[model samples]
Target: MLAPFLIMLREGLEAALIVGIIAGYLRQTGRGHWLPAVWIGIFLAVALSLFTGAAIQLLATGFPQKAQELFEALIGLLAVAVLVGMVFWMRRVARSIRTELHASVDAALAGRDGAAWALIFMVFLATAREGLESVFFLLAIFQQSPSAAAPLGALLGLLAAVAAGWAIYAGALRLDLRRFFRWTGVFILFVAAGLLAGSLRALHEAGLWNSLQQVVFDLGRVLPESSPFGTVLSGLLGYREAPTLGEVIVYIVFLAITVPLFLRPQPAARLGRVTDV
Candidate 1:
């Protein structure tokens, strides 16, 4: 539940921020007439995202047991990939995102021929990327834990993100976005590592992976995952009471590879202050 909540919060805020930037830019440049078209693009993108998620859910319900396991494994792997890529991409682009967005907006409006369509397409692509990423991550989370709490938490997170976006746009709230993203990036890496380990477990269940089946240790009697605190840990950090050798190895290796690179120093760039247009 907590995992889904945080993931959705981050993903929803990203989409909201992108839309806000475009809208702010349009307003600043006195191209406010294009705002309607931007909203249209956002609506279409959102509709597509919802439809895609529902269709996938319906399709998965018909799968047999092993096939379902395979599908879950695939979704988990895809989610991990998408999540990691998004984190790194955001980290790399954060410094110049506003400038790049402004440039894109200018280019969209520069042409008299189908300018509205161009802007609409640009906004659609941006929002849809975030939406699709959320869908896969949500699906993977749901597959791992089939409970009402996960969806409820996700809905709440999205609502909070909407509120945050509006507050930021309205200049009612100030945020330290640099620190926010940095800390959240680290949290997300841990989530992805857990997802990766869970994917391996899913693959084994699907008979696609059979090696490294040895149990590293059994914590079932001491700290069973079914316990309340254990459940929270399981949801947040992918804690398994009787984790296998492969799961532990993969989890550690993923963090070992990603955490340092993410934390390493890079060229100093300002991503702290959002453009107030």
Candidate 2:
């Protein structure tokens, strides 16, 4: 619960900040007329995200148990891809985000007829990227956890994210976002790795993959997944009491390769202009 909450909070806040920056810039530069386009883009992206999640949930609920497992595995795989890509993409663009936003806004407002549409597309794509990422991660989390706690955690995370974004914009929060993102990137890498392993296990259960079906280890008898601590770990890190050899291998390999790559700072990507309160 804590894991998903924090991850979503950070990711959501990042998206919110981008949108806020663009919106604020437009207002400051006497382009307040374009605000409607940005709002439209945001609403549309949100609607699309909600629709996509609902469609996926509806489809999965109709599947058999094995099929559901396979679906979950696929979702986890997708989530892992998005997670890794987001981390890398942010690392590369974090520094230039404000500049990019300004440039984009300028370009969009350069013309009259097509400006709104262009801006709409830009904002929609930006927000939707984050929305889709959130969808898959939350889906994977909810599949593993069938408790109210999961949704509650996500809601709290989202609220926190919004508040944080506002605080940062207002100079109320003096967080070093570069450092924060770096640490969260590391945490997300591990979480994604764990999800990868869980995905493999799901695939195995669905008989889609049989490459590494051997039992790597079993702790079901000693500390079952149903236990309080075990459940918490599983929810946080995709832990399994009786994980298969394939799952363990996949998890380890993902972490081994992704962690180091994620931790290295791209000095060129650090934001240069600091916002004054």
What's the lDDT for all of these models? 0.89, 0.84
| Residue pairs with clashing backbones, model 1 | none
User: Clashes in each model (backbone N, CA, C under 3 Å)?
Assistant: 0, 0
TM-score of 1: 0.96
Candidate 1 residue 132 Cα shift, in angstroms, is 0.3
Which candidate tops TM-score? 1
Residue 72 CA error for candidate 2 (Å)? 1.2
lDDT of 2 by residue, 29-125 (tens): 8888889999999899999999999999998999999999999999999989989998888877776788888888888778878989999998998
Worst 10 residues of 2 by lDDT: 268-277
The positional error of residue 97 in candidate 1, measured at the CA in angstroms, is: 0.5
Give TM-scores for every candidate, taking all chains together and pairing residue i with residue i.
0.96, 0.92
